[model samples]
Target: MKRPTLSKKIDQLIYRNHKSATTNVIGCLVLHAIRSEIFERFQRAYVGMANKESSELGNLPTSPMAERARTCETTGERLRNRELAYGFDLDYKNDPPTLVPCTWSKNYAIGLYGRIGLQCYNLQNGTNLKFKRLEKHSTKRTGRYSSVYITLDATDPATGSVCSFQTQFSNAGSHLRLRARITWLTFAARIKQIPNEPIDDDWDEDTPGINEFYKVPLPKWFSDERGSKKYYVPESELHDNDWLQLLMEVAFFSKANRRLDAYLPLELNSVVVETLEDEPRDKLKADNAIFYISYKCCADPCSTPLAGDHRAVVRKTMDGKPGHMCLEVAFTKEQNKNEEE
Candidate 1:
């Protein structure tokens, strides 16, 4: 009969030395793995104990057979009594992987096209001018909105100096005519991870607003946990020490579209900030100050504009509300035709 494999032979030996002096290569490899933190608590309890080590320098007894017997006896006792070390609180194989919240920030600027200007609506004299406004929307349509207004750089080309004039009409108007033709420019946003509270329960995928926000699907291994409020996954789903793999997987599955280049889960605020100078500007900013406002989009690059949720019109609130700023931009036929093209 063929000789049994070294591992099988070692298992039969059970760490006990045979009468013939022979080395236990299989046993040594196992002991080395234990010492390297491969197992939860085995190394700390049985490592370096008398008669347990494979080498003679481990204070082994004079008799090899006796030393082997002692090693197996002590190890067996520990294993039978269920005293295996458990370093982790949850089961390594079963616990849900935790995702922490994080924050990211970027220095953003909003400006109109270079050498482009809008027809001065309220000015007594028609002067070419441009304007930019920071708009914030409300979760509830109480017909209220807010804006952060900044001074526009509007001056006559002949003077070669910026000028300022006060008028009652809103500078936030559509249609910024350009003196020169503009080319398409691409931009990308920077993402950083921060620490935030983890969700043990299921995250609500059925939430109304979230559906419009998140576009990517969850990972295949994710479990809904019987209609809970969060996504649950095994802690061991990703290989240990494969941190980059984990990050990429999360980013790939995140609903932020490819607009999200990176993700950091262990951050503090879970804040997402995109600057006007970043990649999403094309989808979020005005095209020559005359295009419709775009809403949340999917990751499919080939998807049609009709497939997107188009928030084509903007309206300013007329109600005398101190808390919100409501402004409106009507969708023109020209704009609609341009969107279709």
Candidate 2:
């Protein structure tokens, strides 16, 4: 056998003299991912990779590796136990998109979509499940369609008992159309060991609603979610960072779509807004929601501002999800100069 030198092109790798050359490959890769285009290609290759990350709590795969992991400790868990080691949740490349719960509770827009999914499922299955509240949700984004997986508890009228559910949907173009859809949905099973209407336990808490629903809802509109609620908000709320950005974007694209020419919104004018709520006509209730913003945006950044009222149809919700939601300019309505002034 040839002598194995510590490193290539070197006589020896003196372990003591040089602290072992740490490859630090992961760190390097992370840096490269941020700096290089190759990382984007890598991300594209694994765009839907989380579809295979099914080792979530209740949805754990029956694979041998997963089976063994269930009985004992996982390598990650072992690493976590060691004080010397540390873990970064969803910080690394290829990690499952982080799940959002602590935040979704306050996000009214997300709650709107969750209701739409439940409403659609009810329409198709001939079941009336009243929405209680959102528990959590996650999402995977792509250029054209961003996939959403949502979890929440609901009230089953037939049983008059509370039940929990998970649903998956996409925000493509199914805005306020009953032709809207959810990819899959599931509810908590009544296991004897689980007591009291089978509410959320550790197993239920960790269970994901990505690819499994008890039954398909709205086979026709099953690819997306659509529906929206409308109410007046204090003008101050419109200036919130996320809301302002979204409204501006909606303003920019709305003008561009009709004109087919490049245009941008320079300023947002505060005004009491009239909101529109559209209901889908076909299979299920609308889950893709649209928001009506009666606000003005400057067409020419350097010129005098013109007043305009626009409605934004925001379809998607962020991932974790509060990450990304779709928004659209429904229509640009003209405001009388007298009123605008």
Candidate 3:
């Protein structure tokens, strides 16, 4: 039998929601197109592997081929789940909110595509999660006002953990808030504890508590409730410095209907206000244009910076206009040369 096409499935879903008239048909179509592209790429890889034969002998390697096929099948199932999570259906009311698997190659795509799917769902069906709009600001007088808000709650299904959500409105317009929200079910779930080590200090009796000789601390998991000595384990040896793994859910909200436009007066000439040594001067000069800017916390926000850290530059020319300035931003790590030296 022939397999059903993604477009066909989308059409069926759209038809089912015909009565409600609340569905964003175009949004669904866009999701379908993305899924189709991903599926085709996965299928091509699978087929290529299946057709390959073993090199040394005359026979093909059945085990590796079978494993590849299984991996492809798993990938296909994940894609299907993603479609269902984003697809419009009447039965979604009874289903739980799920995360779509993100491919390593297309990790960045998750933010945009996931937001589109989420916003569409929010518009069609009101979620139980709640949030408060904090403030709205506008840089350009003629442009739309950007609203900022905080997510009250978030829940993660994999670990049954909950966390407070916070995000800024880069897409907020005058009337619409495009921010994402946590589902009510996820918000209600209880948080789970992560395994961690406890710290201990052994000091000399004669020394002051503030300035006493001390010993290294033990891991929390190895320490008893009394906090004196490390709890001994019979079967396995534990270390004091092991890292703990905790799972938390977080959500992003993008507001819509507002476009912030930046226009630089052409007559004004560009000048280098200040230049630092060892900086990418050429790239910096390319991005000195006036434009709407959005900021988000850098990945690994808690990580310490090192020397010779690098960041990629992202630049966009304003509406492709000539003599228009481009805005560029780069993520770089701050280094403490004094400490290293």
Give the top-scoring candidate (lDDT): 2
Candidate 3: tens digits of C-alpha lDDT, residues 4-38: 88668766776665646656777667766777787
lDDT of 2 by residue, 96-201 (tens): 4332433436444455456545654554455767778776666655445554556667888688898765544455542222222121222222111211222221
Better of 1 and 2 by TM-score: 2
Candidates 1 and 3, the one with greater lDDT: 1
Distance from true location, Cα of 299 in model 1, Å: 14
User: Which whole-number lDDT from 0 to 100 does residue 252 have in model 3?
Assistant: 13
Worst 10 residues of 1 by lDDT: 184-193
- TM-scores for all candidates: the values are 0.17, 0.30, 0.15
Q: What tens digits encode model 1's per-residue C-alpha lDDT throughout 170-247? A: 123232231111111111010111221121211233544222212221112223342322212233432331221322
User: Cα miss at 13, model 2 (Å)?
Assistant: 56
Displacement of residue 172 (Cα, Å) in model 1 is 13
Model 2 residue 244 CA deviation (Å) reads 29
lDDT of each: 0.28, 0.40, 0.27
Q: Rank the candidate models, highest TM-score first.
A: 2, 1, 3
